[model samples]
Target: MKYILDFDIAAVCISCITLFLFYERKQRRFGPGESYGRIAWTVLLSSVFSAASSYFANALPGTSGAATMATVTLFYLFHNSIAFFAAVYILNYGGLLPVKKTMRVLLALPWAIAIAAVASNPITRLISYVDSANVYRRGPLFFILYLLSTLYFLIIIAALFFKRSHYRKSHQRAFLAAALAPVLAALIQGFNRGLMLECFGASVSALLALITIQNASELMDGQSGLYHRESFIEFLAGAFKKKEPFTVLIAHSPELADLQGSLEMQNYRALVAQVSKWMFQASGAGAAPSWVGTGVFGLLFSRRLKSNPVGDLALKILDLADASWSVGSLHVKVPFKVTILQCPEDAADISDVVDCIDQIAEVARHSAHKKIYTKFDFSVGKHKRSSAVAAALERCLERESPELFYQPVYSIARSKPFALEVLLGLSLVNNEQAFQSEVLSTAEKMGVSRQLTELTLKKAFEWHAANKQELAGIDQLQLRLVSSMCLDLDWPRTVLKTAADARMDLSKVCFEITETTVSRFGNDLAMNMELLTGKGVSFALDDFGSGYTNLVKLAPMPFSIIKFDKKIIQPGLQSNKGRQLLEGMVDIFKRRECAVAAEGVETEAQAGMLALMNFDHLQGYLFGKPMSGQRIVEALKNG
Candidate 1:
């Protein structure tokens, strides 16, 4: 009885201390619940009851079996009640249990039943016995019932401990150890004279003390580290859930292969690790640096830290690392750029933060300067314009927003519009600005240029199909083909099949290929052109004089028409060298039985000069700027 009193007091003291420490860690790890102080109060109340039951059982004086039965029953009920609550706590803290009324009811059921049974007269007597010295000893059935209850409680605690271990975050192992200590101790005490349980509890206390010391050492070393992704996500979610402003700075290294080639591979990795360490130190006293990918690091901090602090921190770290990278023999010294997106400033979701950073990284890659960081700027007019253009293009698939514009290609000898050059005009929605020329470049970078070109061609075909009479009047309608589109075998094959399905005349469609497209795509050009020409579609060389154009390059290719670049024609009317080059190009095309067209003539003089040089077509502002099909028909009527 004397030892029982000591054991009860010690158990109560240890329980209170552990619970207090657990809660303190929980607050630092996870914030308060919606009920504010309710969780802590409930846990404290359960501990008090457990402590009280232990005290009363030790203090009770009676050899009467009925009184001993009553004491053991109360103690068992109190212990089980706390066990149930601890299970619920672990599940909730691990994020396995949802915070709902139904979940709360389910978690509270075991505790409620235990409380009711302890208060009931019949069950209490059935569960306990009194020994000869007025001491409480469990009955034969008591051992069985206690074993089952203990096993069940230990199973719950063990399940939670293992489940949480997989997370492997800071303090998770220590928390698991703390939760497991009492369960292991109780299992030992059930067989032995409570000696092992007491020793285990003391050992756990020592281990916890050691952990605290290690944490303090890490803190002194300026390392507040998190080892898993879930912890980072939970941390961010907590900050965002509370509507607290924060910033997420994502630093992406150049591709590892790219970096590896720049310097010795080992040296590069060492440099990266050093930079990562520096980033954590610079971010804050408690910043956790996470390596999200081989070359990507994520640092999350409170927005109240400073104004544009991520940018400043990134620059400072880069400067200190002194990253001098060499690719082959070329020495390139630069800092890694940091892209920052603010929480509740840029987006509410973590996924959106990731996407915004990805877009910023893409923009940074194309930017010319090195070591320059970019923040997500929703107000950038250029980005808005590009988005509007992409949206308008999407709408074009459903409605006729894109119209066909035609430029007349006149026959100098015939003095008539022999061929029509089809141009694409996108109808802007509302006050939406059209895409700049770089929009096409952007699409190419996004791997959608071929699709955009095919869409344009399809729109042209749809227009031609609707206006058979206008198309029939023209000797030929020339459509400018993007070189990239020709290189796409699947797209070109699809276009051919579509044209065949529509019963469109391939002879009426003259595809003008830019010289650069031919140069870039090379032999694929020759092969695709040969297939289309075999299908009775004529091909012309567009932008002839520009883009590394050489006679040697043009001699072996099959082209029905040769169009002089605007650069050659614009100055040829006044410059002798330009005039000679224009005449020479025309003569060469004539000898090859290819018609020649002069582009960009703006005056009657330029037009007359082109006509005199035996150009088969005169295409420029002098005749008319590219206009809609209806306007072209009206021009034809007026002329």
Candidate 2:
């Protein structure tokens, strides 16, 4: 190789390697994103021409043949075109530029400028020249091209600096470094014309940017080597767009958080690695296993596989995870909940799929038996229905629209009521009530649970304040809050603020928490409950004796009431022995100074039995079905 080919050969080799690394980085089965794939091709082609353009300089004045001149002209044209293309890609990668383009031709202006110069360069020789020694020399107009090229570098830095707040510190540093690398090289080579530096510098800088940042695989968890939530969602979106028949199985270990707290970080990482290895091995090339959350791994597989039903696939994953592994002499068995959903079957849209998975995962996580669940299916029409529901709900909130309803909890001693349980639910477009909506759930998953809770509370408080006078005894109002809403750190404060705004006594308000919430209790729940209980706001253990109601864990809870779930109540109302069990549970709660209520009392016989059992309250259609706030008030007046 000639001494002149040193930088050119180095640039070509580095560019080729960078391109290979870019392609090799994606371990996802879903493939790269459109923008990501486009940018990769631009970078590869740009780097290739950066090296190729160097050779045209060797064809000099002695080689006056039109063929040589044409080759040199074409090389510079391509070289300059790629230069501008690379700058645009960098801007795109840095997220400093907008993704949408109404007119793609509008973006071609920079390339057009470069091409016009290259087209005119042969007649003018402004961009290049053949020296007397048959060597290449820079023309006067070459400085203008150089200026435009360097301007791209400056634009990248300026754009990134403007949007510095949008990026993480590491990303900001990497991108700035990537931009500066070529500029500094251009400056050095400009001072010493014999030293070729710009192409070589840009190639190395790209490699640095690839390794340090500007990588999609950076979406993977650093330790686990699996897709993080953001990347997994991106992968999911691609799958949805493809409309390919595929099954997504999510395994979430609620215990992972606890384990992370208990073990050393290094030991925890090692354990995660072991679990990931199991996931990969179990997947066996057919499925792309990704760590979606703390201990949640999602396996995505196309339908064209040798497989049984989704239930069997879930079972195999469960059995696969059941294997015991040790982390620093500590033997651990990871028990996880499996929730599976199939595309175009369960859901076709990305949002519906996410909502379905999240809802099913939540149910399975707290379930008494973590059986393979496949019940989360939506018809083709349901996607539009769900979107309409979300939009209707959003409109409802914006208008301060209230969907307030109340179920009467009656005193068993008389036919009169003990309290009215306020039930505010999201009304769908079809006027069907979905108390906990997928939109709300998605908000919770996205950490906007606080805002969702605030919106619900705001409307509820508004309705209550407006009807306070008509509602007579407002103190008898009890609210049933979703567990996910309570998990928001701001929920406690929101409750206090709403209560103050409504001019309601906190002591008179009661919050009912279901067994589902209590069983899967976290620190957020514990803290929020304390905030309420501290203000003399009463709590009722709603759906008591439901699945996973661990009485031992419930010991320290500040519950003033216990309402028996229909699962417990119906069976108790069935047999004499079952009735005895019910009485025994009532006695246990009474001993703890909690008022006990029997729910689902649909019969006069059941009502008599509940009354005889000394249950403090009875709630069922036999007393009064849930109705609008106005009807509830009218009913109270009539009674």
Candidate 3:
């Protein structure tokens, strides 16, 4: 039987090219780098051995039978080994590989049996033997090698079938083609041994594995040189499904947002690469970190109880972030907030983990300095609930059915409610203030703050219009407005038009802006306030003393009222210096002709003290909790 060396030579060349490509590729440690590595090398070896066996079998005419036998044996050995390695790779890729040593050994038993049968072939003369002319010939048990290859392909197919949901359609096709290529080539060679197609099939499988699994472009972030978000999610879901315990350290850099386009491209890449490399090393998990968002990077490492305390890890990460990074001529300090989440311990699944990451990253973006967010600060359940409330609120806003409640701001001197503060109510969230914070933050993130403001304004004006008699005694109807609305020059016109459409009295309306908003957009907000103030709309500085508020900046603003946050009022009730500070602020506002209102006045003592301090409007539970418009009308009528 004559053997063709042309196909063998071509297969060897293709295999070499595949192996070279795999070697030169940028490999991610967390991916199937090692598995694809073995496949590449093994396929190259298989092709080389197959070509050598063909050479020696026909070329070593009537001289050295030992060389022919050895080469033939090696060709079959590596050919079978290719199938074995590919099967292991697929199993691991599907996250079906057993973690236990015993189970892993059981999984490898068939490949081990194939190795044993091939090794004992020279004496037993069962697989391949050198004939009298030094030509390779199939033995009695030669089909055993084919059977083993078929068995591995079957296992791969079964895994692909069962784990179909785990991978995308493109990946499923790649896996299927990779597994089927070798089997189809084997079938072709099995029917005609002279065809020499097995090595070609091995080359095809190597190319597929290299392109699809080993060095896939989707697995990496171009800027950070880390795994991308989709890859991270897929890896995390696999871990969750396997029930493997791990800890994730998610760090977000707020400075990255500011430094985005300022630095040169090379410097930006270098900075991101430096941070990613440092994070991967700090994780100690031998896996690559991932770029989850613009400034968010997530490090998922194996959980070690004794060695790796999540708190200490978070501190170490924060400390590393504190170091100054030199990017070209720029010496920048990128602040990072690290949040720690434990698998199965902190989160129920991958969805919860993702929600927790978003919530913490959002908090980190707003925070000023390096901080660590632990499970205690923001738990999975709390994040999920906040997410649920945000989702529900979004739906409500879209439907234009946002629920609003009114809380009375009682007058200390007149002993009557002087103002009604409108609060956005969410039955999903228990606390009124928390609900407002969530709505504002959610609206900002969802890019619907303007929609929320417009809806709330329209609703408040309509309520006031319908119940004009009930609100006649109230001096002001206060509405909380987000700062983004003030950035628009036409925001005042929009507010006035909404009030006009509802036929509500604009003089009876007061818009409240948080101290944080005033500090951020003081110039724009002041202009908007002045515009609205000229049209008989009052502006109140809400949540004063709870954020970064500058007194000098506040003086230039046209706010008619100052509502102190509970953080200030509660502390004022506890200490003498706090009371002095409160009195001084009140006196300053009084001189400015701004009516100072004390919020969160829950008890008689708080109300009495605030009243004594000459707080014109006293608010909180002492006056009345936030109630619906109808309930507010009833409360006012009953009083």
Candidate 4:
């Protein structure tokens, strides 16, 4: 070989060795892919075949020249064929190759034919011939086959190159470049014999070495340094494989996108990255950390610890990362919440970890200010108390444990009761105190908020049905329908059907919806309300001005009654601005042929004020606290 060629070959060999060493190191630090394993086997196989072919070529002198040439040709063919398969395997594993079976078969056919041809050709005359000088000289067919194989390899590498280019991560590109270098070198060598191809191989090996070094550095830094979802999943798998009793801590920066658009995005991202680093460090003890999503980071541990890992990590993150970073000087701080999943206790597989993290992220997204961390509790009891309140609410439904109390709405002009607004009361079975908001919120969560609303409506309807003769003079009864239940298709249909079967006068029953429910459900409220109102049932917007009420929602909905929320009426009955807005709303409702009821009239002054403001009805503790049917009946009779 010429000096340059010798140097080139030495460089190629060195590159291959470097790549092999790097591959070994990476396999140790991370895990190996099936394709990596196959490629390694192929490299070993190709090297053996190349050596055998070179030896046979050198040996084909004078005696059995044809057979020696043929053996050498066969070895070359087998080596190249296996190389093609290795390329195919790598591309397929990387999801770069077409997955269609037909496409794969078509791609493999050429290499398969070449292998078959070489195995069948006993004389090897197709690729080489023994000249009278007893030297094995290449035939035209040999060059053609070489060109064909080289072109095939080039096509495969090109496909992978294009595929890798689409990926955003720098590490992924480096990995792909490392994997493709050998194939590119082999292709260059097939077309020309000189130092160029060998130089290419050396350069490729150097790049592969860089990839290994960079990844190792990242691993040492406790960062998987893989910026792709695939890498995170692989890391998770390894964590499970090692049977590490680790907790997966998921932190979501809900305002990430918003921050990105703001002036503070750069600083915000830096803060988040810093927090992520601290969180990983705080997790400590064989914790394999990765950024699983744009806003999510995951940590895998080898053993479960007694300490509250999530809380500790969260505090560290809050300390290191500016938890108070604001966007655009708006003083709006993004909420950061963390969820911890301990191995075996939280999940047994990577998928379970992912799911738990997602669930926690959802919870975190809804968390109030400063409520930053939560743990995945599998105990049916714990979740029911916290996240799964709705799930356990079925027990409450069976007992009909919720009671209905009525507050009378009195007509201001006649000084007579016009309607009674029904409210839900949940007295716990064990005399345990529970938040009314929680009971209702749990019902909403459990998807039984509608059921509870319907139950309240049913009890009120039953009371009215039995007392219709005694209260025959009364024109209407206002029953509070949770705005959530009004949005519930099933519950509304069932309630309406039950009301229809009872032959209850629809005009006498006014369905009231709370302001909070209206804001939460929004346009979702319209459909259920329309269904009931179309049946002659009057609808009331209860607790107006307390939620995101606007003239727009009221204008479109068939609200025959508007009940001012207590917040709007209390401490504001005397305020001119408050009264003006209320009066304006009442005026708007009155123009639409609606009656307005003022709620929370604690004093005769408040009532007198409301009566003068043209409120059609008034209600409050001043009139009566929500009382039992008997008390309401007595109050009506006495008045």
Candidate 5:
């Protein structure tokens, strides 16, 4: 009874190493995605135990009796358990498992029966055998164990492949590839008995799953050896959870296509690979560079290795990125721009930081300047960053640094602008193009949104009165109100008073309410809305197609205008099914005597499509970008 090195022992060693590494990596997972880790670890442990027990079945002690019988039968039991539970893991990961815990347990009944049979096999001698020669091997009944595992693996592979849309593509590929290993190995081994393929095959597949999913993580991006967008977000989310502050410098390559177009695809790929490596090297040793888009790179730096106010750092990184790419004397200067956002300064949280960066990117895309830095333009810059932003917004609202600009909503039936939406202008610190929603959100979070709204409306009324003679051609002035603000039970009175006090007509104003605000407010808001409608204050459902809306929800509400959200409308204009859906909505609204408007109509094609669908109004950059009150007055005077 000398111990020997065999395939099973080798398999056990490999599985043990994989599990050890897996548990080590498991220490870092946070919040979500922890469930996937639990599933993977469970599958690994079951596979490990299965491999461990198989060792004794491949060998025998010089003595044979109950000890041999016990050891051999345990192997069959572990193998049976592996077969049953591996399928369970697959079903669970694929989200095909039963909802009820009792049903799930019932589903495991067949595996339990197989385990019981193996347990009683010492007398039954069904799956395991200790022959007269004192050597142990799998009996004819053991083939059933392989059959079960094979069947399950095939089913799992087929399920994942066929239902590919249900899963993340990365996860689907990994599971499909991993599931193929053991089943394929079983088939190969069925042809040749001497090949110890199943043990190593299963171990390698498990390791593949671990590396592809649980381990590769934020540290690596597949084979590129660079961080990806998801990794950057994951890493930053973890950092934010720990209250760790940092700056993100995003660089977008505007001329990446031009550079790639000049070269062969393979050479361009190689050039990008070199550029990625250069980015990592240039972004300071402590900084992490992630490929956020095909032509964009993001460098994340913590306080330990960087300074606050990352404008200078962003310029430096851009300098590094925009330099000439010398590939065998073919130098290509990449035209790019960098957008810098400091956390807890520009944004209070990770979500806000993401939003700020997105807005900055939008500005950068439209900006004619080669370089732009986000620094405060207001005198309140000396204050704390978050406070300064909030104060700057308040000051912007009160003083009308930019003021309420008007974007005319073109009426298709009239073939002219019948109304103009009063969009709040942003000319705060840095003269940045601030998102209205974000600014108002900051105001709301700071308990000043109500005051801000009042200030904005008051300004709008003042401008409307001064230009009332000039703006007589324009029929209505649309203003936006959040559900909370709209349903405050006093907004209806405030609307009438504000207009009356300014000597501006309340009959000419239409208030747009966001769907999210409406859905969140329930019946109380509907009652308040009806009160406004009764007073001749026309209401528009803003961003209609963005949220869950149906006749049941929309019928009770008092709405005179239905403004289609850009996202749902844009696609509907492109596809027949989507167009039909939009047509149905337009028809329903038309029947209800509601004027249908489409928001974010940026193209002639979009305007034409919506016009053909009998939409009444179109609002977007296509008609006119939101302009200062002076600009609107000038346009009116000139005409």
Candidate 6:
């Protein structure tokens, strides 16, 4: 009865190592990880018991009878449970089981029966027992338990096969090997009884499962420790396919860019991780938290154990966000814009849900205040319009057919055109109502703002080259830079190269930056402006008085022109106080030797008022509306 313990010893060592690796990963366990964790624990314990059982059973007549029986009973208890736990893991991993207590209890029935039989084996001597000689022997009911265990393995294999389409190829292979390796070895040992391969099979299965299924880096953000965007989207898609009721809450941080710019890279990552942990804890059971995009986090509560209290969770999150967060010697406030959407009610399919999330995230990025949005508050029309524009933008950029319009900036001093502003002639609807801001913002989201800028510059410079003889009176060609391009460090050199390629005079180019973009600019923007300004290009602070205008802050940036926002000029024409303010602003700019332009001037009185205020330039409907390059050139020729 002396059995070779080579396989049992090897299994014990391998399972111990596998279990150590599983726990050492320290991943935030999603549903599949939790189930696989159970399997890891079960397989490791089963291997230990299997090795001990072999030692006692091999000693035969020399081993203590009671001691042998106890070890043998524990071995059967743990060894027979591996298949049952594996089956449960498979069900959970495949999303076959709902997150319900009742369903879980039903799923545990077979394992419960196996545990009961094994626990009572000493008295009944049904499944396994130790003889008087202290040798382990199978009882009459041994095959019954073995058959039940084999049934569980069969179910795992079948589930893996039938659900193959639902999983990636790698997942299918890993799950199949996990189910088949153990059962095949067990079946061989069940017939021969000499080869102790059962535990070895379990160890192999555990190792395979842990390596493939428990690798979190594939599905999670390395910094935030939350599921990545694709993983989160796939989870939602699966839940939707199952018709599982669910709600998603998106938390977008408007200050994320500011935080990134302020903090060191490591410190910034720590801040993101802290925020991610807080969001994850607030989500209820069966909830999955994901880092959907930069500055955007999504919490999906699917098949939740209880009702989805997403609204309260969002409110609580915002309340917490109101306070300052302490991260690595920095006390910073991370503002959030929260929105909740329910499946089948708010979104019809995965595409709809993705589109809605994208558009909402975009809105949240620019929103100034913290607020909450319910399903009813989400604008379906806005989402549809933005989505359409985004799609059209992609096509328009690829085809290089986006329209460009030119508007003249009138010189009040000389009573003629001083500059021609290049504008993107983009519209959201067929009516051709201007949506250049929306188009530019969408281009930023799509990572094509730089492309749009390049295309506009190429077309404008080429048109100017083609119509060099048309009036020959334009002093400057003004091109507005979007926020994304302004933040890019390479923009200065790249734009100069673009201009050089077009053979355009650098002295005649004026780059317009909006007032809001000024606050977000860092040293890189200043350096970029210096580089371009060194090349004889002028810079204009566009849309002044529209936002928090700090003249002292603008003093160091080397802006040569300040354009008054329409909101500023309209009021200046109506009231004495407004006129005084306008005149004072104009006088300050003039003293600094910076030319001032009044934008949005439309009437004779408004034009006269701006002229009296000592505005050097005027641009509005009163001067000229945005028209085609050809028409604009023809008008300049006729005038």
Q: What are the per-model numbers of colliding residue pairs?
A: 2, 0, 0, 1, 1, 0
Model 4 lDDT, residue 256, Cα: 50
Lowest lDDT sum, 10 consecutive residues, model 6, at 24-33
TM-score of each: 0.52, 0.58, 0.66, 0.45, 0.42, 0.52
Candidate 4: worst 10 consecutive residues by lDDT? 376-385
Q: Write the per-residue lDDT of candidate 2 for residues 234-291, one digit (tens) a residue.
A: 6676566555788788776766646889999998999899888777776653465777
Question: What local distance difference test score does each model get?
Answer: 0.60, 0.69, 0.80, 0.61, 0.68, 0.79
Candidate 1 lDDT over residue span 469-577, tens digit each: 7556677778877756866665558668767666677878898888888778776677777887888889899888777876676776789998888876786778888
Write model 3 residue lDDT over 251-361, tens digit each, in one string: 878777567788887888888888777776676544447888877887776665556656675777778666998888788888777777778888778777787666765
Q: Give the TM-score of candidate 6.
A: 0.52
lDDT of 4 by residue, 1-639 (tens): 211334334544654664566565443233323234444444444444444444455665635775665556655564555446545644543445655679878887777777765665455566666678777666657665556566665765565566765333664555556546655775767576423343444244344534552344544323333234555566676556554466566666666535556546556556555555555556653454566765566665445455555656666655534555433344445555566666666666765666655455456545546445544332223332443344335655897655667777788877877777767655544444344457677776666777777666666777788899877767777766665665545666687676776667776887777766666776667776787777778878887877777676566677888888788888567688977877787787888898888878889889887877889988888888888789888877887
lDDT by residue for model 6 (1-639), tens: 556678988988998788677666554356445666677777777777777777877777786777777877788788878888888767767776556779778767777788888899999999877876556788888777777787777777777777776567888889888888987887788687778898898889888877787777798889788888988876776667566677777877768756878789988998898888888777743477888887788777764646657777888878866777788888888877788777778876666666656676556545555387655545555656667788778878888987888899999878899899888866545554445677888898889998898888888887887787783798899988888777667878777788788887888889999877888885567778888899899999999998997777687787899999998789778989988988998999998899999889899888888888888899999989999888998898889
Give the TM-score comparing model 2 with the true structure, all chains together: 0.58
How many residue pairs of model 2 clash at the backbone? Answer: 0
lDDT of 5 by residue, 62-144 (tens): 45455656654655555555555655656655556566769867767767767777787877777777777777656778766
Candidate 2, residue 10: how far the Cα is off, in Å: 4.2
The root-mean-square deviation over C-alpha atoms between each candidate and the true structure, in angstroms, is: 11.4, 8.8, 7.3, 15.4, 20.9, 10.7
Q: Which of the numbered candidates is closest to the native, going by highest TM-score?
A: 3
Ranking by lDDT: 3, 6, 2, 5, 4, 1
In TM-score terms, candidate 4 sits at 0.45
Off by over 4 Å in 5: 1-389, 397-402
Candidate 3 vs candidate 5: the TM-score winner is 3
